[model samples]
Structures are given as structure tokens and as C-alpha cells.
Target: MKSRSQDTAIHALGIDFVELSADRVVMSMAVGPSTHQPAGILHGGASVLLAETAASIASEINIAEKNKYAAVGLEINANHLRSKRDGMVTATATPIHIGRRTMVWDIRITDESDQLICISRCTVAIVEKR
Candidate 1:
């Protein structure tokens, strides 16, 4: 599969898709000035964006290839656990539910030391392309 990091918002945020599969997706982003908040830590919104991106992409991949569908995020929530000052943070998204109309994913962001940085969940709506 082609990387989604070429020219999208993911690329703008310096997010790279490391692993993608039917059931799981992994992405990583560098913790630098661009991703930091005023307090000098990884921004919560950046983590949420990474979570949503992973879930949305995984949801799209889980759809039938023959079906013309688009996965759109209906809802998302994130809990910032720990603060990351530098290094890279990785997010892993796994399916919680995969239904015909909606999909739910659980995403976990971890620091380079494997410390939990954020936990998030995203719900995506699967709609047929017109």
C-alpha cells in the first residue's frame, strides 16, 4: 500500500505511517518544536490527530475492496497520560468494532521508552461514495 504521508496533513504534522494492516495500524511522529505546545511538551491535539488518522485509515482498509466507500471520523476522544518532551512518539491503532456502518478503534500513543503518552478512541462512519 502507498504511504499516506506524502502530502496530507499527516505529512505536515511530520507523521509517518510505519505499519498498516487489516486489523492494526502504526504511526510515529517526532516530538519537536512543531509538535510542541507552549509549555514545551507534545501537544494533546497532535496526539489526537495521529490517533484519528490511524483509525480512519485502518477503517478504510477494512472496507471491502469492491465497495466504493469512504471512512469519515464521526467522533474522537483522547486522554493525555504522560508528557513527552523530545524523541519520537508512536501510536498504535487497533479495531474495537468493525461493523457495516461504523467502526471504532482504540489508539495508544507511547514515547520512545514505551511509556504511555496518550490513549484515544475514534469512531468512523462508513458511507458509500457517490
Candidate 2:
């Protein structure tokens, strides 16, 4: 499988893929200075980035023709459930709805101890490549 972590936000944020499939995508990012807010906690924006990346990648995998279609993020929302200081945070994204033009994904980010850190929903739009 081609790696998705090249010259993208995923690469900039240090996100590592744990699993990838049409139905689900799992990725991990370490909580460090790069991902930390000024308050020294994991930045909520970073969590949202992880969520949208997973959803967009999953939607792309569902596309019938990679050369003809592309998946782009249409909308995304994240709810921070908990805060983490340091360690790894893993994001798991699963499809809520897969459609002809749009795919919705539910993403949950959890800490190393399996505690929920954030929950997000992302809508990906499939567009014809021009």
C-alpha cells in the first residue's frame, strides 16, 4: 500500500498509520511539543487534523477509480473529551455513511491507556479529477 504520509498535514503532524482499510483507518501521533498547545496540552486542532485525515483517506480507498476521483474533506467537527499531557494518542475512524458523492466518518481519539481524548465526525466529498 502506498503510504499517505508524504508532504501533507499528516506528515507535518507526525501521524503514523497503524491500520488502513476502506471501512476503517487507524493512526497514532505522539503528544509532544509539536502537538502541544501553549497550555502544554494536546492541541484540539491537532486532534481534528488526525480525525479528518483518517476519514479522507478511508473515503479515498472507497473510490472506484483513483485516477478519476479524489476525496476531499467537506466538513469536520471535533469534541474534546479529555486532555493529555504526554504519550501517544491513537485515532480510529469508521464510516458512518458512504454515498456516491459524500462519505461521513466517526473518529475517536484515545490515549495510550484507552481513555477517550476526542471524538469527531468528518464529511468527505468525492469529486471528479479534472
Candidate 3:
């Protein structure tokens, strides 16, 4: 996998990659004031960001021509299954479809006890870098 840019949302949100493979990717994020909503629970938008970021990175890893191609998020939808006050949430992304033009990934966000917090499906488009 390539190094993540320092100024991106992933960095800003403190998302850390836990595992990386050809077929799956795992990432973790802290849930606190930074990711909390008005009620002090984990924000749905933050969960979506974690899912999409993991999916996008997984798609980028699958790209053979890194210099000529880039992976970008095409569409994403996430269901907030549960709410958390403060802790760590882990997201696991597995590919549903890996095609030439687009890749679909299923991402599941879990809490510390492995309970589902959010479920997401993300479509990533492989486009020319330029």
C-alpha cells in the first residue's frame, strides 16, 4: 500500500490502517470529541468517512498501474447501526466487485466488543491520474 497524504481527511480524523491485503483492508479510528456528534455519540458521517477511506485505499492497492491510475470514491452509503460514546471503532473493508472501471466494497464498522456500529457499501472509480 502507498503512504497516505498528511493533509487528507484520513489524517485529520486519526484513521489508522490495521491490516492491508489484496482482498481486504482494516482500519481503526478513535471516537471522542473529535468524532462525536451533538449528543456526544459517534457521528454517522465520520463512520462513513472511515468506511470510504478504507475502501478507497483497498481499491488503490488493487490498481496495478499506480503511476497512471488513481482510485476515487464514486458512491457510498452507510447505515448507522449503533451509537457509541467514546472508544475505538474498527472498520473492515472487503471487495464485492473488482472491475476495470469500478470496484465495490462492503465495509463493516465494529466497536470494541465486535458489535456492528455501521455497515457501508462503497463504489470506487479507477481513473487516470491526470
Candidate 4:
């Protein structure tokens, strides 16, 4: 479980969760000064962070056993399709594969007007804490 203080990234980015089902998650965030690149568009790292965070949150919610299971990102690859300036972006994530020790997630990012912004794939390794 994470404290509210530890989840400041969501608040700092003004992110909202629209759909958070068992295996799928959809979130939106408004573009802010901190999220912009020097080119005046949304930063590439911000998009990747959004995808990574969404996938991690989905995995975290699936933890139900006595021992705490942590999802550590092992691999992530994302491609930027388009650029937007100062607008709300929505990200949707669903698990492509979930195994006992590894999970692969697919994420799609789109702007408020339904334009593709980025696509990402993330892999996480599950670890049990003693």
C-alpha cells in the first residue's frame, strides 16, 4: 500500500482515473508547465512515466496475498506518434500477458480530441518481500 504522500505524481500532474478495472486502466492528465518540453509540447519522458505509472498501479491493486508483492519495471519501450501542446492527455493500459513472475502491459495515449499521442509497452517483474 502506498501513502497519499507517496502518490504525489498523480496529484502533481492533475491526473484522473476514469476506468480502473481488474486488468485495464484508463487515466487522464492535464498538460502543465512541468510536463512540457523545451519544444513547447508534452515531454516524451512524461508520456513514458504515465504509461509506467498506470501499469504499476494496476499491478499493485492485484496484490492480495499476505506478503507484499512489488512490481519492478524491467523493460519499457514507447513510441511518440504525435505531439500536443497544453492539453489534456488520456492514457489507457491493459495487460498483454500476466504470468507468475512477469507481466507485460500495453498502453495507448491519446489527446482530449482523440488523437494518438504515444504507444508504449512495459514489462514488470514481480517480487515477493519476506
- Please list the residue runs of candidate 2 whose C-alpha ends up more than 4 Å from where it truly belongs after superposition: 1-4
lDDT of each structure? Answer: 0.92, 0.93, 0.94, 0.84
Tens digit per residue, CA lDDT, model 2, 84-106: 98999999999999998999999
TM-score (C-alpha) between model 3 and the true structure: 0.96
Which of the numbered candidates is closest to the native, going by highest lDDT? 3
If ranked by lDDT, best first, what sequence of candidates would result? 3, 2, 1, 4
Q: For model 2, how big is the CA root-mean-square deviation?
A: 1.7
List runs of model 3 lying over 4 Å from the truth.
1-3
**Candidate 3, 1-130: lDDT as tens digits:** 6565587888889999899997999999999999999999999999999999999999999998989999999999998989999999999999999998899999999999999999999999999998
Q: Which is the leading candidate under TM-score?
A: 3
TM-score of 4: 0.88
**In candidate 1, what are the lDDT values of residues 77-124, reduced to their tens digit?**
999999988999999999999998899999999998899999999999
Give the TM-score ranking, best first.
3, 2, 1, 4
Off by over 4 Å in 4: 1-7, 64-66
lDDT of 4 by residue, 17-129 (tens): 78887699898888868899998889999999888878877766665652767877888999999998887999999999877777889999999789999999998878897
Alpha carbon deviation, residue 50, candidate 3 (Å): 0.2
Error of 3 at 16 (Å): 0.6
Model 4 residue 70 lDDT score: 82
